[model samples]
Target chain A: MSGIYSERHTLEKTESASETANEPVKKGDTAEVKESVAVNKMRTEFAALAVNEAFARAAAAAFFSRLDPTVEELTEIKTAVSEAVSNAVIHGYQGGSADKTVVMECEYENSGIIKIAVSDCGVGIKDVEEARRPLFTTGDAEERSGMGFTVMESFMDRVAVESEEGKGTRVTLIKSLDISYYGV
Target chain B: MKTEFEITDNILIAKLSGEIDHHEAADIRSDIDGTYAAFKKKHIIMDFSGVSFVDSSGIGVIMGRYKKTAENGGITAICGCSEYLRSILYMAGIFTIVKEAKNKEDAVKLVKRLEAAESGEIFQEEKEAE
Candidate 1:
């Protein structure tokens, strides 16, 4: 079943989130007593366009949170990816081609960092510098947010976007997991 | 991924199991539209009981579906929302478009009443009196 709707996600291995490491096992301790909490993880893809952006972001957020990302950390990752995926949809698929689909892969890194990679196969970005600029879009009718890359920079610790005009675009973002908020 | 939809009385409930993201949205949209079309139910309730994480993209799915339901003169409600999900929903203004209930039972009741009013099963004057 989809993890999107429930928090009681079952897993293969069990280890509690560091947050649970603090409290003593007092008699009245009624906190979630599960021996270990597993990081929730999800991986999926979407066809390029406005339609798929939201779903991609939501699923990625859920999956990444399992690594114990802070609220701020997660938000930054979401914004960066949202722009990249949106670009893929608007710039890649919207160009009117038969093959459509943007690939997304996310991994939780060992140092509590979440790594997200988004790649597309449609028309590539010819001028990487211009595309990265705030409020710059090749499209006319669909009022571009132009702030796509800007939002990404604001939210993520690292964002590397590589593109070629005729090829495709790949954007990667990484952020460290902040466990202190959870008192881990 | 497996998705389930059912109608109990006048309420339409959809349970989405699996990850909900862009890649899965079209299928989800099709599933939801097909379910609503088949039941012809007036009130729509989505059980987020199984959803673990959601982003703006997921918000688009809910908003898009809500528009479709609203076009049919029906209302949409949500239930079993996690606090994490609720924060995103609130920021996206989902509460402005549809009502949310505490659980599936509460949702069914709310939608049924809306259906009753639409179908004239509940006397308008009597409903006002109560």
Candidate 2:
């Protein structure tokens, strides 16, 4: 879980607002498209680990590539986002190789929302509610702060954890880029 | 990440530097435990002199080290904590068992005295030979 999202807010308190209905993948052009910077990035799945650095780098490249994020807010978003990715890898995989891949998708929805989906097809969670509890640990040897979700919630505007006991887990996060909290 | 170990008068000093979060805890635990197992020291001093920022994951690492020391009948002391990092340490209750020192010499002195008390020998000929 290691990326930076300074101008974003976490949505931990809200339930799953996942519409599940996939709108047609709209490719926006600068002249015709209402939204200026088109939102699209491709990330390869390799086990479960913090992919925020990759995502952040991509986002920074696509959106704020020319502008740099300040050190403090950069650290905040990087740490929290990385932690969220780490949680998906550790808890979602249950430390098994069988849980082969963790899928990550990053897209910009207009100028207001940046949506991220980190999904894993491993042993899904038994309790989504309890898992979000701070200081919770199910790892025998893995040292976790258990505040990954908390930090994610604190940092992002929307955090939705989708999991089924036998299936896997997917965390969808949305954040706003309108605020000046993030460096240009 | 650098880990150094040395035994002086039955006290093992494990110096750890750099950022150690959840990702590195497992391997560090194994290395420290393996070193202590070989030496069987009565006291352990973990010098946190060069650490910058430590998060809650660091708390787990400290707790694991504390457990290891207690189980081996040795006390764990953490020294060289800066004023800036004291809050994180305090929040994690690391001060409860992990003792701090002004410097390395002071920590070594404390460990020597503890060792002397434990073995009940201020100067033993055989212990001094090896």
Candidate 3:
């Protein structure tokens, strides 16, 4: 647990620094102050179990609710998160070893942009391009639709994947909430 | 997820509720398959009025069932999907293989009509009426 926390702390520092650098310097503007204060992030790790898929989705939805996204937007985010977490549990861990952990991190900017990353240190994908193809899956044909990556790509504004064959896989999903719907 | 089954004129109507993700899809697949086989139904109608959320796993379940029924010369129809779910299904090309109905009744009627046409019963009925 300490190791995970330390890793998360390092990630948080790096993200915050980049965010600060990208932020425009606007003096005496309340909106700018509010925007800077709105940046928030969360990270959690759980066992790579099938049931955790639901947990992961709910957690993401709850965290993002501060943005006051519309029902459709929230549903899309939840579905995309579910796909990423499911891929981690089913494919990353190769049948969901309870001992393995899947880490999920979410960060939101005041500008209505949200980014989510799901990672697993399991048998990494050998061919990411092939894996991203629609209807391409190495799992049981009867049980997998092979549309996880496709769903994520369609539902989110951007989807990125990084993996090392023997190390792990990390999927990052980004979406921008409707500006009118942003509460925070 | 929860599924309730009803048989009408030999068509299996499965009423599905709750979120359909990988965690629940396994149970749903088994439930639908078990009921379909046990009842020896020739066609199936999946009612999704109560389904709140679905991911690719839901698509897989539908595809798997469609393949099973199609191999046996039967058909599959889905009804009661919310707008989001319908879009997902359409994106997955599920509508190419599975029929979409307005509701459970429409699905049953559609399957019955198709079955009648397949068995030439509609022609017989027309001739008898004439």
Estimate, for each residue in B63-82, the C-alpha lDDT of model 1 and write its tens digit: 77787777888888888887
List each candidate's DockQ score.
0.06, 0.24, 0.76
lDDT of 2 by residue, A96-160 (tens): 35337666665553354565666778778899888877667677543454656765676567677
TM-score for chain A, prediction 2: 0.64
Worst 10 residues of 2 chain B by lDDT: B121-130
Q: What is the TM-score of chain A alone in each candidate?
A: 0.68, 0.64, 0.80
Which consecutive 10 residues in model 3 chain B have the weakest lDDT in total? B121-130
Give per-residue CA lDDT, model 1, range A29-65, as digits (tens): 3245522222324456765566566667777878876
Encode model 2's per-residue lDDT on B1-130: one tens digit a residue.
7677767766777777765555555566777888888877767777778664344456566777778777877777778776544645565456887777777767877666565677796834333432
Best by DockQ: 3
Best by TM-score: 3
Better of 1 and 2 by TM-score: 2
The CAPRI classification for model 2 reads as acceptable
> Would candidate 3 be rated incorrect, acceptable, medium or high by CAPRI criteria?
medium
| Sliding window of 10 residues with minimal summed lDDT for model 2 chain A | A5-14
Native-referenced Cα lDDT, model 3: 0.83
- Which ranges in model 3 have alpha carbons more than 4 Å from their true place? A1-38, A180-184, B123-130
